[model samples]
Target: MNLFHFSDEGSIDVFLPRVKENRKELPPVVWAIDEEHEFTFFFPRSCPRIVYTRSDEMSDEDRRAFFGATQANIVVTVETGWYERIKRSTVYRYRMPAETFELFDTIAGYYISPRTIVPLAVEPYGNLIDRLIARGVEVRFTPNLHPLREAILNSTLTDFGIHKFDNAARA
Candidate 1:
């Protein structure tokens, strides 16, 4: 089973709805927003998967609640459409090598899963890809555009994998 990690949150929303409308078959795909400084997991059940304000910025009780809510094995994080408009037009032309890899490694360690799919905008370089392969990380290449349909249709988790979070983990 493959873990599909999308670097772009905007595309995820687009793809998810499309999948529902078209009734496409897919594998178990988990999404994590690869942002500049943090890896945010989106929970379909929760209202907000991530807070723009840091934990330190929140009160002790709120911090505890935030961490408490994050205990879910999977989550849904949806970014605002307004921010996506700005990001796509001006801020997306340039790519940072180190920051992108950091995001990948962070998600790998946190999720502790073998497979992950990230957007082409922040895809790892050739050398980093080699390192990931060496470490037994199966990184799948996904398209950068409106690839929601293709991604969901071709996901490994949906095809051959199962989501064991509720039954096994909750037990």
Candidate 2:
């Protein structure tokens, strides 16, 4: 299957192994689709809070506290089969249909971040190319990044936000 990941130019080539040192907890690998709901959820600052689960299922205050007010979240789609084969203890996996996935635009991919992810290549989502360019984010076509380029291209979605990976000390 073809999956997509949205990232800025700096950390596009690297995969994080764990959450930054400052944080007390670690986050699973995360990715999202380009649909409106997913885009809005991932780009928290772009729209109002989107509650995926029933409002009664979890308090609004709890949800907001769990998911920050605004975050530069990266949206990526992983090839389930490939990801499973190389799964590790630190990573956890969660899957949902497009509708459900888009609602919250969040997933727990692994218990721990992958130690290293040297992206095969990086490309810009066509729909968000103009905005990315405006933000001075390098938007280029990395055809050789993955074998499923065509499929990923077709699945590309709208813009959310840009995440810049800091390669300095973890903390």
lDDT of 1 at 15: 22
For residues 85-150, what per-residue lDDT tens digits would candidate 1 score against the true structure? Answer: 322321111122222222224423312222333333433122332333344323232222123223
Show the lowest summed lDDT stretch of 10 residues, model 1.
162-171
What TM-score do all the candidates reach, one by one?
A: 0.19, 0.28
Q: 40, model 2: CA deviation in Å? A: 5.5
Model 2 TM-score on a 0 to 1 scale? 0.28
Leading candidate by lDDT: 2
Q: How many clashing pairs per prediction, in order?
A: 11, 13
